[model samples]
Target: MVKLFNSRSSRPFRIILLVIAAIAAVAACAHADTPPAIVIAPSPFAWSVVVALVVVIIALLGVFLGMVNKSLGKSVQIKATVKKTVEDSYARKIRNEYQAKQALLDKKIEQVRQRFTMVMIKVKNLLDTLDHKELFNAISNLIEVDIGASRYVIFLVDPVKHELYPFRWQGYSDSAVEKFSMSVENAHALTYALKRKQTIYRDAATSDIELRKLLDREPLSNMLVAIPLFGKEKNFGVVHIAAFADGHTEIDESEIRFLSTLPTFIGGALANADIFVQTREELTSAKQVTEHEIAEKRRLQEIFSRYTSAELIESLLRNPEKIDLGGVNKTAAIMFTDIVGFTAFSSRMNPKEVVILMNEYLSRMTEVILDYQGEIDKFIGDAIMARFGVLSDLPYPAKNAVEAACAMMEELELLSSDWANRGLQGFNIRVGIATGEVLAGNIGSSRRQEFTVMGTTVNLASRLETLNKELGTRILVDEATFVQLPRGVKHQKRENVRIRGLDTPVTIYEILEQVKSAKIVSIQPKLDQLASRNNQSTDKDALPDTPPVAGIKRPDN
Candidate 1:
């Protein structure tokens, strides 16, 4: 049984060896065209012959072994290649799906950019139009259909209060104004974004409680976005937006980074608008001020034109700095005048005729006022306001006034004759003269202006003039003025006369005139008699002592 098994094994090995031999023969035949390395030219070439046959057999055997190894290597390599190909096919499938999803994401991001661009277009249009109502409505209706967002809220700023009150509220109710008030000093997202001057977006609405409540009843319950509108030192306001219901947004941090440029532009636009509004207001105010000043200047020119010569007024106006507010101790002449029986004479004429006669009287008085370098403060009907030796650039206003008054009296005499000849009632005038320091200048508003004189000296001179009718004299002179008069101005002694608002009565003089025209010299003794009567009346009337009102100029006009 052993022998039989040996025989079967031997036959199979022999058959396999024969198959190997056939493959070796084909390999040897393929290599037959190649040459031997060294020539066998030795006497002992027999060894070379033997080595060549052995080499042939070894080569044939090596080819047989190589064929068997190559077949086994081919089977192993086919199995490895099949396994690698299967793995690569599965990997390619996964890669294709991942690339497809990435492409979709990229497309969605592009769509978002397009939507933002559309909204910006609308924003630009609204800015150009500058119509508030239209701008608000357009902003409220601005849609980003591709991105699946509904509307936006646009706020215009008021930088003065350091608060963002919505100058324009889009896509929201009036109550929304109170809802979104935020302080910039805080560390919240909106405040942070404003401080950094950039756009800020919270991807999830629930991340911020206030935002969740703001859109609680709305569709944008997923996410919220807040963008600051600011540039340089100015902030226009904020723009808030949200996603639509059933929509998803890929709001990356990098997305908002580039939007900083847009807010800058918006802020610039708002700044320009503010400048335009303020400029318009400034122009309007300037025009109003100019018109008012012009009107006031015209009124003043007309008023002062009545009081003094145009050349003199122009001099005063052109050199207002030359006017000294402080009084100067210089030689001057002060004069006062009054009408006699003017009240009784006015009663004789009708109201219109009285006015005409008064105008005529004032016209004649204006001539004397100008000739004496005097200024008229105001008119009290038939009374006149003339000042001399006060605020006169001339050094001798008092003397000029005295001479003019003398000439006025002579002219009045001639006027009286003319009135009598024309069946008109004739009137007489009393004049007083005093000299003292007095303050004078342009008074009242710079626009509505007046030129006048003030001080106690002016009051005393006026009081002296009023005393004339009671003294029954044409002219009077205070003690101070009498001392400076020329030797020819005749006067009589008069006692101190009690004047209103005076602590003590003033001694005065009466001028009898030269039977033509004159100035007062002395009436001081008569003035004292009136004062004695006033002192007695003071005890009876329980009032300060004052002279009887036999002659007093009433300020009716």
Candidate 2:
């Protein structure tokens, strides 16, 4: 019975017991209520029996109530326990899910970190490699390892050929690789990637028939990934990776993303390498050109020094731009000197002796001309044509010409004395100077060019030089040169004479000598002044009309 009360069926059982107790109490009340034949006054015991019956009923009710309350409490406790168990189960399930997701997230993070590290290392290697071959090798290794590619080929665009040629590759035979070339003009995956400047993912199984046919000869498993290598300005090439025919090797989204990013570094490295190579080649070429120029300058100096003054040669070398092949019209002092009686002198002497004497005479005269900063235009047999203020503008070209002429006369006298001492015939030289405008520049054919002056001034100087023999004078000058002569120079006006190539008579002057005590003014300051003024205008008329020569004072009248 106790077990029955404790069981789930106990509620109905207790209710049946309560209903039976009520019926028994009602029967006892009915009996008591009935008029008993033997009783006049209600017996105390009867009342007490009724009271006891009532008390028993109340006690049973109380016990049943208490049992009901206890059942309710037990039911509440059971519900609480069941709810706690459900909450614990749910928490466990939730914890497991959280842990799973967290683990997966951590794995992804680690993968990203690893990819980053690998990319950094590969980029460093690419940067360190300067040579093209080494750079290609590094790129191949980077792709194969970092991208988890089974086979890969790096193709560089041949801009001229309009094609893509493999620069580096793996998992392909040399012959196959060499034979494999794709025209960028063709419509294909590689070209598409290059044209779009993006990564292209192609599945051989689903790819177009044309693409599949193109890949049939290659050692590709099934999948192809074409990543365009971008440079700073243009596309360098494409990196083609073959993979995924086998189930074990697959390219995930992460690897695809990595591959996409890798081309930037690769392209930059390639561009930098190309620039380095070009710069090196350019520097080498420039060095060769500079060396050649130096050597040519040396050769030119050696040859030119044999004719012109050292100072003139140095100036020309310093400012090579001054020696333009195109002629320029400028006012210059032209001087000509000739050995008197040279034809007769050579006729009497043997060929070797004639050469030796002529060389000695020319050498002495050349020394005097160069001492005055003159350019020996050319040596015509026994005659020398020299110029002052032709290569460079001089403030005192006329004075320099006159001084040079006088110095040559003195030098010839010394040579004559030397030749007399040596038991050789003494020689005489006549000089002529004229100041006027002339065309000065290199003049000749392409094969052989000579720097000389041409114009009326040159003709007049030559004619005056020949006139010296007729006038019985050693040095003769035109009026233009005489007016510019220094005050201390000994000169006299001559009768006007007509010369070859001139329709009018030309006034001449004989330059006897220059004052030995006169001091030579440095030409550097005047050259600087002239240079500054010439910068404003290069026209011939811009020059001073009658600039006096330096190193000597000009005559007042």
TM per candidate: 0.37, 0.42
Question: Candidate 1 on 336-399: residue-level lDDT in tens?
Answer: 6777887788888888876766677778878867766776667766666666644446533444
Q: Residues 234-323, candidate 2, lDDT per residue (tens digit)? A: 688887777532434445555555666776887888776552222222322333334445455565565476777645665666566676
Residue range with the least summed lDDT across 10 consecutive positions in model 2:
275-284
The residue-level lDDT of candidate 2 at 421 comes to 89
Q: What is the lDDT of residue 234 in candidate 1?
A: 63
RMSD, every candidate, angstroms:
28.7, 27.7
How badly does each model clash, as a count of residue pairs? 22, 2
List of clashing residue pairs for candidate 2: 396-549, 521-551
